[model samples]
Target chain A: MEFNLLAAFFATLTVATYFLTNIVYLRYRKTLLNPVLASTAILAIVLVMANVSYDTYMTGGSWVGTLLGPAVVALAIPLYKQRDLLFTNLIPVISGIVAGVTVGMASGVLFTQLFRFSEQLILTVLPKSLTTPVAMQVASNLGGIPSLAAVFVMVAGFTGYILGPSLLSWLHIDSAIGRGIGLGTSAHGMGTAKAFEYGQQEASMSSVAMTLSAVLGALLGPIAAWLLL
Target chain B: MKYIYTLLHILVIVGFYLMGEQLQDFFNIPLPGSIIGFLLLFTALMLKIYRLEWIESGAHFVLAFLPLYFIPATVGVIEYGKLFSGKGILLIPIVMASTFLAMASAGWVSQYAAKRKERSD
Candidate 1:
């Protein structure tokens, strides 16, 4: 059927584009050239050029999206693997993530309000610092558009990846844990990727921070919306 | 044989996700099912209810493609043309400034805590 063929084509296109972009990203190691960002931009342009509707593309794209749930559950593995470090640095880790989550949510709400964005936009921005899947979920839970939230999350990631290192050094935060927490809490996966450049300890710490922030961000998202918006 | 093993591992991970979804619907929990499954799996690992090896390869395989999973959602933004027009440009500065604030606060707090711990030790 035409439907099946179109679905298969779009799906293959998504995967192939991602595959190529990922290779480029790994080779060049530029934050701006992140595979997700590049592939999304590329695919968006291609779809528009082809005059393909979003729904039509999604018939295939949804197959890829379906894996996200299992991927999220798989997150527990890294969290568990890092359990020892997490416990050893429990106080600092917990305090850092809590502060980051609170500040991130509060600042987003404040700025959106200052700009006089709609309630929906405010909710979308509320979970901007969370990892993508979690942010999208939190956004929807707070009555925001999930896809819009995903865009906000990517913006947050890019912002943190670009500015985080300078901000950390300026603050004299030389500790691996500090750098890790800063990047991961503020940027999510992209931040964690940046943390890897710092060293093994920082990378692991960042991953833990990213995971914990996702959990904390989810719990706090609705509360922040209730209080601020 | 290896492929089968990987598929089986994926099935287990998916099973946990389904369980989480079921529990959420039954309890009317506000949390997303994936997160609930995340917590459940973490607890299971901590309690030794599931060995890491059983799920490690599958988890790695899935996580490796994690970024790929969200492309469709991001591409969905093409639908909302108004968001990126005019005043929407202002969102960049807002997001950047807020991200800096978050990075600064989290870094400062953790650095302070870590230094204090070092001194005490």
Candidate 2:
């Protein structure tokens, strides 16, 4: 098959699977089977079964990839919606995010060193806590492969979504604001999705934290890379 | 008229991005055009120059479709299949632990601060 045709086919197939997976997740609301994880897994399996190379998939995939920037800008809407809460908790929220992102970046570097991954991999792991679009840009700016950075972001999101509630409860940090910030700052979009289950306050705060973390992560990403690498 | 309003909102978003692109070039930094655009849009709303109602529909439209956009990039992870070998095997646990740490510390500090403020009040 021609490369363009294959790319188009896979792109359509991937989007369709994501739509279907989202329906299943909505019906089931299972954390283990979240749309992002489930859809990615199903598409990966399909590609492997079809013997399609990643390169071919990405050709048409890039069409979807191009929207990342605009979607990121759209995040400002939620941020704006929560403007009153932001103004009210301005100092504590900023401090919390500053602390969270700092710790998150530092620990990512610390783990990469402890694990003895390559220099290239170090850059990839540094911005793992941000949303995928912002994390990809941060990683690319810091000399990492953008796609690899997306994978790392997904890992962080998945772990946070799966374990966030348990971890929050174990720590006895019961504040809705804190729970939202914790999950959102650490896990990004997926974490915020889970936060919605907790309540409206948690969900909104998660959005706030997600936006703040993305901005702070972007600003701090280069500085962290320079200091660590 | 509503369609035109939405179109105008979309144009405003794209315009900010273009401005952000210029700022990115002028600053000679790694900050993304979209982020800078986000900042610009945020400032505008905060200043009351643009109302949320103007862009809410457009922004929500884009956001609702956000995950679909990431599908291609996630698929690209297959290219790094080699990372699963060697030290890469340890990545998942380490990443999970770090994510937990971030959540714990952030949650702890924020909760502490909020409690302190409440007590003072």
Q: Which candidate is the best by DockQ?
A: 1
Off by over 4 Å in 1: none
Q: What is candidate 2's lDDT per residue for A1-229, written digit by digit as tens?
A: 5977977876788778889998998899888777777888888888888888888788888877877887777788888888898888876677777888999999999999887888788888899999998899898888888988888889999888888999999999899879988988899998998899999988988889989999899999989988987
* Candidate 1 chain B weakest ten by summed lDDT: B80-89
Docking class of predicted structure 2 = medium
Q: Candidate 1 docking: what grade?
A: high
- Per-residue CA lDDT of model 2 for B1-121, tens digit only, reads 8778777777767677778778988997578888988898898888999889888877877788788888888887777778777558687787888899888888888888877878887
Q: Would you estimate the TM-scores of all the predictions? A: 0.97, 0.95
* Best model number under TM-score: 1
CA lDDT, every model vs. true structure: 0.90, 0.85
- The parts of candidate 2 lying over 4 Å away from their true place are A1-4, B1-8
lDDT tens per residue, model 1, A86-150: 99999999999999999999999999999998899889888999999899999998999998888
